[model samples]
Target: MSPVRRRALVVTLPFALAWAVVLAVFTGLRDRLPDPLATHFGPGGEADGFTGPGAFLSVASAVLIGSGLLIALGVLRTRTALRAQRPVVAIGYGTAGLLGYAFASVLFANADAVRASRVSEPVWQLGVAFGVACATGALGWLIAGRDTAPEDDPEGSAAPARLPLADGEVATWTRTVGSPVLLFGGVVAVLVGAVLAAVGPGVQAWLIVIGLISAAPARCRVTVDRRGLTVAPWFAPWPRKRIPLARIERATSGAANALSLGGWGYRITGRGSALVFRSGDALFLRLATGREFAVTVDDAATAAALLNALIERERGTSEQRG
Candidate 1:
């Protein structure tokens, strides 16, 4: 009934059940294999290059189960430190070390076999290797990338505390638009051609006019106020979305990765919604209307805390009114 016990049960019980199920299935399948298949891999068959179905299953199970066990063990070993609220730096280092070892083991064991295998074309092989490397590298980075501890800032103090403002008021946010030369030139050419066409006409002039119109610059803007948020991309018309603080459900902070949430721009994931930009820190907002708003901002943790506080205030007001 303690927090640690509750956390341990939540984390370990399902994992243990999953492992048991996996082991049961594996054992059942192995037991059902015909004698011939089981015996196909004779003594030292792994090194002898006798890779039959049984051998494949054995190797697959070892890799899968071994990796899972390693991860579980790591988590268990670090659980105490994590509960003690240790800095993330140590956890990241430990994670990176474990993943690095796992990746190295896989590469050393089968690199040659993978290179010689004809099941996949060279391009496919390269793609698989590249994908694995990228995954491993990303995991390593996430675990060991940056230390989040604030040296000067005291613990429990608001990180870069928000500047004082009028009660119940929000500050405006602004983003500057880039001047696109190509777009401006095209628009000017088209307008000139249109004017000329009204006086005198030619096919070349019409073509020029069309080209100019098509080359117009895209419009983009970033707007923020006391109520909520708004952002418009250049190529498409901006949606009239203004999320009031009263309607926000929750706000959470997470990493910005394309694989995790598709390619950044205005993605709707199963968890909620997000309007992600290509770069910078991201804040995910779950709204009461079942929409999610993903925003890129300078200080994400502060923003999330502020938003959460605002939502709590709104709820308090509603309850009081009722």
Candidate 2:
């Protein structure tokens, strides 16, 4: 087997085994349990039958296990593609499974009675199964999704030569200017404050106004050019601070744990050393000066590959000259 296939099988095997075990236990329990609703409707309830908790658990386990396996298969098959695209596809499959269950429930099950009871036993069972499957699938994708080598440029152009920074050239990391989420939140807050101010005049109304002003978006930027690295906040009257690139020890991409990192406006994390633009991935720059800078950009892997290529070219040129 190819390395990719081997890796996929290894990761998926344990989960599959666990799922089967759980399914067997659930089935056994369902066959042995007595009907709970039997007392409610007397003898009629006995005739109506009872679906045990084990049945629900079995369904959930199946969904979770099945989804996980499918996600693993997807990763194994699409190992060379871009990282961001894989999750979307895997998640889509999980979502479809949930929708399928919902459709079945609506067509054949008593959805109104389920809702009236407020128990949602079936939905919960199916959701848990679906969620487990999706989570495992996502995990599989993350573990096996990386490409060992940089993808070739589609343009088929020769690689560019890297020019050394001539004494004063600098490298910096900075945040992107403007955040749509912060702006939207600020606008909403301001509108709410205005409404409160118009309704009544009091200390609380002024407090709302203050809160609105304080919540306004703040901008920060990092720039590196011929001069040096500079970091400055947007919409602020301040001088930019210069930082040298030689101080940069390493740069790596940040993983998005929550959708928050890649959703609605700018999100800064990793101790504020990284910034991700509206729905963009983060890049971390570890400087020799013991400071880190983070910037969010689109297609981080491609950028990283290009930067690595440039660095290799520069090193080669230096060696040839010496």
Q: lDDT values of the candidates?
A: 0.44, 0.44
Off by over 4 Å in 2: 1-176, 203-221, 226-247, 253-272, 289-292, 298-322
- RMSD, one per candidate, in order: 19.0, 14.1
Question: What C-alpha lDDT, on a 0 to 100 scale, does residue 283 get in candidate 2?
Answer: 47
Candidate 1, residues 1-322, lDDT tens digits: the string is: 6533443343333234434544554455543433223211112323212245456445545644554453444333332322222222233333333333332333233422432221212224334545544554454344332323222211122332233444576556545333243355457667767665554323137656654543532234555454655556555544434577767776665445332332234455444555544334556666788766665545555666666665665677789899
Give per-residue lDDT, candidate 1, residue 97.
37
Measured against the true structure, the TM-scores of the candidates, in listed sequence, are: 0.33, 0.33
Q: Model 2 residue 175 lDDT?
A: 40
Tens digits of lDDT, candidate 2, 1-322: 8655654554455455555554554444443334331101112111222344545555556665775575456446533333333444444444544534432332233222332222223435455667765765576456535634233221123232233444433333234455454555566667767765565434135555654543443344655442334556566635444544445444455334222232223333223333433333544555666665555554444433334334444455658899
* Clashing residue pairs for model 1: 92-143, 273-292, 275-294
lDDT for model 2, on a 0 to 1 scale? Answer: 0.44
Report residue 100 deviation for candidate 2 (angstroms): 33
